[model samples]
Target chain A: MTTLTETRVDEMSFTSPKPKRRIPWGSIVSAILLSLGAVVMIAPFMWIIQAAFGETARAFVLPPRWLPANPSLENFESVFEQVPYGMFMFNSVKIAVIVTLGQLITCSTAAYAFARLEFRGKNVLFMLLISALMIPGQVTLVPLFIVMRQLGLYNTHAALILPALINPFGVFLLRQFFMTIPKDLEDAARVDGANVFTIYWRIILPLSGPILTTLAILTFVTMWNSYFLPLIMINDPELQVLTVGLTLLRGQYGAGALGPIAAALAMAIVPVLVVFLMLQKYIIKSIVSTGIKG
Target chain B: MSEQIMTVRSLKRREAMAAYAFILPTLLGFLVFVVGPMLASFALSLFDWNLLTPPEYVGLANWEKLFSDARVGGIYVNTLRLSLMVVFSNMTFGLLFAILLDSKLPVLIRNFFRISYFFPYVVSAVAVSLIWTFLFNRDLGPLNYYLGLLGVDSRINWLNSSQWSPLAIVIADVWKNVGFYILVFLGGMQAISRDFYEAAEVDGANTWQKFRNITLPLLSPTILFLLVISIIGALQIFEQPQILTSGGPGDATRTIVLYIYEQGFKFFDMGYAATLAISLFAIILVLTIIQFRLSRRWVFYQ
Candidate 1:
């Protein structure tokens, strides 16, 4: 009688048994599927890196070897010897840096005015700026190429640097970032007799480190990888940046030096990889912050 | 109040000056580079000018040639087909993969996959094209080797077939770029509130039902944005086709941009090229307008 009473008591405490801790089937399946995807996505890059240090003929071997036994830096040596590799690297670095700096200053100034200053036609002007963003870069390429030719900037680093420096994306992105700051900070600066220029330079600019970092990375990557503008603007072989340089290298290899090209490709990725590693935090932040607005 | 008004007026003038100063570089650059060239391309389009000689005004001849040019239609069709295939497939798969990634998984594993997918977006186009070329090679390529193992004919010239040529190009293009759209979709998915899912779960809704009722509605705006931008971008497709095929085995893969590049640079037919540019510009504009108009019926924003 006592045992029967205890069983009834246990039954009373138990409502519906929590659904047998459902096998985390979803997580396991997704993990497996995504891992496969990761492999597929990363394979080509790996292949290229292998091919870069690979022998021209052997690089094309069926069953594709993931590891090259005789990986050498000869391809890199050839890239330096056969082409203006150093000059190209220097051009890319110099142009990207100067353009990034130029964008930071010019875009920040314009963004500050749009975000803070109240002026007549401010809305209209800002609208025009934003609308310009929709105009495809290709539409402007031919005209810009001609303009560069006329200005004697054709086949020069300036042609690459100048057009990129005045990016609408930079202006727009910086303005959005600047708007996030509380107005009270600027007002406080103003009441302290800070001029608009002084306020922007001293207070507003300093507070915008993260966004500025984001913009810097964006501008750097865009300019660094840009091909068409440089293709049209720079005709001289020596003036070629890495994109054109790589193209030239591809042509020179003529289907034989896959390993060297792969190695060269691996070399090509170093700057981008460096930049990515350095500012990955800001990159994620910028992308995430934009999603909230969306 | 009077003193504030005076300060406001001075500030307005100061702001105007600052606007000019701030916009000076951009406007000057725009005028010199973009606006100035746009006018020039228009004027150049009316002229029979090679780089070697002064431009001779040829009126409607360039446009006339463009309409009747045997190759023009082929180029247009190739470009349109490629763009449509890429835009549709990229969006479809990008959304699917994003959904998969957003499912409950280990944080480290998920982020690793996310970064891996995004790797292609950062790599050079030339490298990607070269890599695909090797993979698609008939005799030595892994693709044929696999086909042979499956008892299928291994002699297929993947990039040589006029019909399959465009498909091959499209596949490569999609593989390289789907990650970018995936990132966009993932961002959209994360923005959706968990409460919606919780509510659905409480209602005994299945995953598909929850996705249809809740996820798709919330994600539509991002989808619309991606759709329009992708359409616009795909229309100007150049690098991959240019490098991989050079429009291949005849003009099978020649895109409008490639056509323009050929006309403007290779043949130095600036007028003809400019005419091609204007046509491309019109098509892109129309597509964008259509997307904007269509957004009203489908796109849901909260």
Candidate 2:
């Protein structure tokens, strides 16, 4: 069963278990090097935390204090006071939730149809959708903004949420996953008198826990971290997502207001960070799947 | 016989209808947001409209202006430089990180390094830019501060200077995106069977030789895949530079999309923005075609 978790690694020519009789210099070196790289990768988060709580609020500081001289929650407090940080997070969460949920529903159904159903123009329609995967969102940015204006979705979360609901990548990913499902299962369901929709909801979805989880986590991450859409679609602070709000905060507080912006950055990053930490396995699995097939 | 055929045809039609019903939501959205807007973007490129006045047909005037605009050249140059720098740096570091992560470590430790490295990639660009802005602080920026410890006389400001701003943004862009490449490379690495290494070892192949002859050859497909994606994505890079330098110190960090945003929204040159958008699309499309054409020579798939 080529479930999404299947790594699809080919028959290796190098699987001999090395005799670790000596110092194992290679492993040690790799471990040390990897740790250092991870530190560099993670150093920014540490700085963000320290700066969020640091007493120093300037943009340019010499002999930068990696450890804070005096740590405080003042920056976090000020972030809330200065901008509606809470509202931005809430708005972001709301839109992300809707988009993720909507994508799961719409994309799953479409993927199921694409993968399993036989229709006259199935190949043609699938080709159309796949061709769109290459088209950059910026190609349609100005026109999309105008269309949003025409639909009265301008400055509304719908502008962010609606376009997000039908991502080609999401559809493509799920369709690929669905195509991997065995025909025997559907045959079994038909033998039990389950209709197409019933089989989809009951058997397919339930059986697709791994791929669905992968899709959900990925969709949420993309939606949460999305910047360009919200930056363009909504102008109001109340409606703007966290990414756009933090940017606007830069404009408002100036780059010099480092402490509060870090605090805001910390706040903005927490939700997605939490999800990532909790569901990282699925996330990694999704990437592996995409890498092999992409 | 005719009635029986009609019954079967009607049943097939019912199945097709059910399929369409399932796909309708996505199809409608694709029409409205993706396809329709793309068509409209093309149309808008032909005319001058500021969203207030009725669109006046300029008949290729916008395209003419796009080619003639001096800033367009500068913008493309800056964009190409940034994209090439970021994509190359990200791929190299990503391959390094992937190699490290793929080595024989405790599975838990490997997972930790893998997850932590990708933390920045998951964070929003605005937030990443914010954190980096603090880290880039001239007086107390951690980077210069570290350099100071190395006795490098380290008072450096990256954001404001036109000379350094592009590289600064490139660093942050690489940081933001390198995690993705690492994931891709690691995935590609994992997909390579250990049999190749075993064969290489039997042949007494050195580490670099094994990697080049076996691993690198096999990994070319992934590299080629990433080449396409990273370049296409690099072309549309807007948010990072926008937040980092705001095209700073005089158009130094201004990428193509950033320029598009400026033209369409800030300058209300919607037609010009649309033209740039189409130009950007054409460039990406042409480049993608070229990459595919060239891939056959280098990319190896098993």
All candidates: DockQ: 0.45, 0.54
Report the C-alpha displacement of residue A118, candidate 1, in angstroms. Answer: 3.8
Error (Å) of candidate 1 at residue B243 is 0.5
lDDT of 2: 0.83
Worst 10 residues of 2 chain B by lDDT: B131-140
Model 1 CA deviation exceeding 4 Å by range: A1-13, A17-25, A284-294, B1-11, B147-153
lDDT of 2 by residue, A1-294 (tens): 665334433323246465557997888888888888888888888777777777635423554556677778888888888888789989988988888888889999999999998887888888899899878887898999999999999999989889989977878888888888898999897778787899889878987888777777777877887888888889889888888889788877877788888888877776678877887777767755665221
TM-score of each: 0.92, 0.92
Model 2 ranges with Cα > 4 A deviation? A1-28, A56-62, A291-294, B1-6
Q: Which ten residues in a row have the lowest lDDT in candidate 1 chain A?
A: A285-294
lDDT tens per residue, model 1, B1-302? 99999988887788678767777787777667666776777777788978788778899999999989999998899898888998999899899899998877678776677677876666667667777777777787766777788899987787888877788787787777887878889989999999999999999999999999999999999899888878888888888788778887799888999889888878988788888887888788788888899999998886
Interface RMSD, all models, one decimal each?
Answer: 3.1, 2.4
